[model samples]
Target: SKTVSTILVTGGSSGIGKCIAIECYRQGAFITLVARNEEKLLQAKKEVEKCAINDKQVVLCISVDVSSDYSQVESVIKQAQEKLGPVDMLVNCAGTSMSGKFEEVEVDRFKKLMEVNYLGSVYPTRAVITTMKERRMGRIMFVSSQAGQIGLFGYTAYSPSKFALRGLAESLQMEIKPYNIYVTVAYPPDTDTPGLAEENKTKPLETRLISETSGVCQPEQVAKIVVRDAIVTMGLFRTIALFYLGSFDSIVRRCMIQREQSKAADKRE
Candidate 1:
């Protein structure tokens, strides 16, 4: 079994990130939760601690905007290492989403989504990669969405940011492989989370109708899959490729069904 003694999770205050933290804690890894919300970070720390196998297992929280400053993120990561020891696993779960047609969406919204969803993952990975390489042992997982795999209605601003993660994961995996570092990218379907609720407010009606066809998945379920995949000894490239294929298959199947339904309606007319 891969040794995952110390774990750091960004966006750990809620949603899939929080669930991943809890799952990792359950596996006996010391957890560090990072998010922009101090209150939520503290709350998440309390929840993660409950899953700790022993009192000695430290559950820490850092309140920092992952998209804001790399220096601040690096500082917090250093502090976390000092208290909890080296991070054996880093999960890049910090991200944001928005929904609108490209023309209607504000340009700033596109930049903001990219900053949080793409660079948010990049900054933390940059912070940890050097140490992980020097130690020649580590695992990194990026929490990408099914939206990342394929463009979707009203997600023009959100999809590209996530798509960028896939490119990062692939290139980073190859570069880090010789150093014994592993990278895994997760493509979870629309998950039931507070973030999803917020996105729903801005989601276009067409987007809502299309997304609903695939239904919603639980954060816990996605977290479980992510953790499991992260620890697997399978080649990083193979793992990531399979994840994309599976998500792509789901998308294609859903679209075909929608098309068939449209044709049936046309026939009736």
Candidate 2:
């Protein structure tokens, strides 16, 4: 069966989410935007409408907290599928952060970060996986971070959540390969988004230093490249040029060493 014209994006109300939603709309893909804030979702819908070349449909904003649970995510997905038809693609962008030394960060904050960043993708993937599997076709992309690719100081809470997502994508890719469900994990350089700017102000100096050193790519630039990659990739880590994979491996090793040293010092103190 030819896929439907719609794509679903979580966290689509703002930042890179909003940018990608707009880009997809401009490319004539009908979009279903999922986010927690109704007002922000409406604003995103307006932006998508402005960019849309086809008046076929502007965009459908489904206010949803994708992290809550399977039932909640499934309910939203059902509504979107009913209204927009089968979702041809899903971009899991809903995420949150809890930055502080691990000891300074509260347990609740850590759990909240994990719920929103990791389980946010899990719940929605659970909702859509069966259908995509049955159809044997779909595209799923994750807006992971350089933190996931290479941990910086004080991402104690945030890094683990994104790292879990990378692992999830790796596992799911293998499982879905035979079904032709492509999965791409994107590692965007720090992007100048409203959320990112807010994070910059509060981030620990060490974390800020790393971000300052690594050029902050614009949201539009990351969005366009990610969309293009999503369209072109086959499945899993395969289509990602091997050099990046090798580079990612090296970074992960270095990060692990740094984390070990930090943990040891904390234990001694």
Candidate 3:
């Protein structure tokens, strides 16, 4: 197994982020939780600490709005590094979603979703990437949704932001592959999270129906799959599928490749 000693998780105060933090802590990593809510960050820190292997294991929390300012995100990451040493892994779990028809959702809401979902991941990755490059070793994971791979009804504002993350992950993988850093994107289905609960409140009927086709998953389960994929050294465009819909893209791609191969063989014959 890969040894990841220090981990920084954005949105670590709740949902998938909190679960990832606790799971990494259980695996003996020094955990740093960053989010906007001070109360929740403190609570997450306490929960993660309980999973620490020994008293020396550290669990720290920093309250900051990841989408508000890039410099602030960079500074907080630096502080965490000073306390826990260089981060071996950075999980971009800080994101939000809005569900409604394209026209019904305000233009500002689309922008807000982009800022929180896309730039939120970008800022922190920008902060630590250089150090990881200097060391020529690290792991990065982006928590994109199943909707990212396949567009879904009511996710017009949300899906595009997630799709942007896949683009970022693919491009970053190309640039960072030579540095020995691993990048993985995870597509989890509708998960039972506080964020999801809030999203459901505004979710359109059609959107809810589309999402219900794929059963929900627990945050803990998704976290395990994400962490496991992050540790493995892999090529660019690697995706972790946590549910049926999450694997749809990969399945379609595989079929296309198989068809092409068959055609090539027939031509040779």
Please give the RMSD of candidate 3 to the true structure: 9.9
lDDT of 1 by residue, 53-102 (tens): 77678888898998899999999999998888888999999998888888
Selected candidate, larger TM-score, 1 vs 2: 1
lDDT of each: 0.88, 0.83, 0.87
Give TM-scores for every candidate, taking all chains together and pairing residue i with residue i.
0.86, 0.86, 0.86
Q: What's the candidate order when arranged by decreasing lDDT?
A: 1, 3, 2
lDDT digits (tens) for residues 1-269 of candidate 2: 33335799999999998899988887888899999889988888888898867557648888878887689789889988888778888999888664677788777888888889999999888888888988978899988898998777899888888898989998677667656788988888788888887777668787777778888888888999999999986655664566866566566557756877999999999
Off-target runs (Cα >4 Å) in candidate 1 are: 1-4, 233-235, 239-269
| Model 2 Cα shift for residue 74 (angstroms) | 0.2
| lDDT at position 20, candidate 3 | 96
Candidate 3 per-residue lDDT over residues 185-242, each given as its tens digit: 9899999999999999989999888888998999999998888878754734434333
Q: Against the correct fold, how does model 1 do in TM-score?
A: 0.86
Clashes per candidate (backbone, < 3 Å): 0, 0, 0
Question: Could you tell me how far off, in angstroms, the CA of residue 95 lies in candidate 2 after the best superposition?
Answer: 0.9
The candidates, ranked best first by TM-score, are 1, 3, 2
